[model samples]
Target: MNDSVNRPADGAPISVVLAGGGTAGHVEPAMAVADALTALHPDVRITALGTARGLETRLVPERGYHLELITPVPLPRKPTGDLVRLPGRVRRAVRQTRHVFDDVAVDVVIGFGGYVALPAYLAARGGVRRRRVPVVIHEANATAGIANKVGARSAQRVLSAVPGSGLKDAEVIGVPVRAAITALDRAAQRAEARAAFGLPDDTPVLLVFGGSQGAASINRAVSAAAGELARSGVAVLHAYGAKNTLDLRTPEPGDPPYVAVPYLNRMDLAYAAADLAICRSGAMTVAEVSAVGLPAVYVPLPIGNGEQRLNALPVVNAGGGLLVDDADLTPRFVAEVADALLTDPPRLSAMTSAAAQVGHRDAAERVAAVALDIALSGRAARGRRR
Candidate 1:
């Protein structure tokens, strides 16, 4: 795709573009791969492609990457008023993204699958510009998103964060998680992790959370059952999300302590302190806990194509986690199931090993290496053509 001089000045950096963003689920993986690329190839020039309206607008820059902004053009799942305008909107986004690719002389384009990714994939495939480049796509959801489904056919390689992602022949590489989590050693940091969260060193701790805004059902159920868990000598570390508030279950004189917070920016500490988790089965959440070898009770969001259930199924099947329907995750269920598992050290230990076995701590590095290799191959092809 580089139509300029046959080669750059000696020692010039190899350029790579990462595309995706909307939620932290998409952004974090892109950033993790960026981090891996920077670490592994010091001479690499990293560029992020995302929409102005996505989390990447702020997060990518904050992480020290140059983010190229484009307009967001969301596709309607069904025929709607938005469908009439989609063609023009998508065309405009593709043009903008194509400009970015040409401007950067991109050697390869890697997409993590989101609204922005569709345009990046198109641009990398040459689109109206007639400048083809190698394309790599990563699907982080258990079910492939529309962008990934469309992009995978044209990609040089397809990667999935979880099993059963519905992408044909896609390699299961796990999610590219935050380095903090992949490096966490719960066994080594157990005491320090508990102390960091003001948790008792000797008691079993159960961690509960939903998504970022918090799941109202989880909050209500877990908050109501906190007193029961405390009475059973089990402590709690609950993240109520920034938008929701927990009706605190006041600890009595002889009860185990309960810690509640509006948000947990330091999930590393939470994962380290937790003996088990009761949380949603978002791809990132599943990947992180599985990487750290933490057992969990997953309550998938009852909305959208039922992908969350698919996300937790592999772990649950592997004996590393349990998937409970959202409607069934009541206070009684939490107590009976979560408590039963937490109290059984032998079961938890086996589950821990099972989870670790399925997780990939080096996923970021592995994905980065794949992208970099394609970039190198693309350059070599260009050299031969010259």
Candidate 2:
């Protein structure tokens, strides 16, 4: 699919091409950066390149941006018979993106690390010979994913969500969180938020979420430990994800004093209401937790070459949260960590301070500034040539 138009002439609207998909982790950052650009430079035109197979087809358009679909083939983790098809798919995606660049006259390409992002990076480097459009990549996870690894060599600037990933030209700008999360006033909203979420005014609440889709291992462990946590005077708000809720038998009546929901549409309220959090260490999750200054116990997903562990390391090291491996996650362990964090006021306060320290709540604005600069610089160079 191709979505294209001439760049607006008002200050020569920087035509930005964002490529990433497959999950909310990848797509959300791209949107955050796009929103940042729109806020900083109203004339800047943003378009997204993604595959229909990924979540972008739904998410990008839903966010009021143009979505361009391209054919994407999964890269093999290990060499297999399907490996031969990889080259052909890559060629097709590259060709499609080339057409997209030509149609849109894209000035810069920003990639947020995913297989769907590869074509746009290749097109920016190989197909657009005249403009030399700047390519920027943001790696949101600790261990760089395969897409970012390939995109890095050609990227003009690399921005990392976590620090010291051994990537050159990398800046630790923190992951871009949604605008709503950044706008919250923790001290001002805490009391009212607690009441809104149906928790006692003074009860210490622990917010638990696996992710948008949720993690079964985390959900199971937290459910089993709910009673223990409640007995310690900690209230629980758990989002079990829609898919996992069916298999999770309901707690017996009058058991754990907690609220269980499949999803949370109002994360601002949830964050404001919580005293602490237990969550997966996805890049977006880390940013949101840090943005809101909530102490956390992070359980990184045990998959994809331990990428989640790498994402959580910075926050864990900074004393913002504790990282526990999935192998180590158990009902007893979950209860113990939750109890300790919620009950210890001094420790919880320290963690919140540390989290706030590392969080760059204005990262989206910074990213947008870079995008606008690249676009304006490209335009100036073109004018000089003419």
Residue-pair clashes per candidate, as listed?
0, 0
Over 1-386, each residue of candidate 1 has an lDDT whose tens digit, in order, gives 22222234344577888988788889999999999988877768888988878889888999999998887878789999899998888899899988888788788888998778888887777745386888889988989988998989989999988767888889999999879999999989889889988889999999998977789999999888877787678999999888887897557897877888988988998999999999999988888989999999999999999989988888889999988999998888878876798889999999999999888798898888888777777676777888
Give every collision pair in model 2: none
TM-scores for all candidates: the values are 0.95, 0.92
Which tens-of-lDDT digit does each residue in 27-50 have in candidate 2?
999998888878776667788988
Provide C-alpha RMSD values for all models, in order. 3.2, 4.0
lDDT of 1 at 125: 79
Residue 326 error for model 2, in Å?
1.4
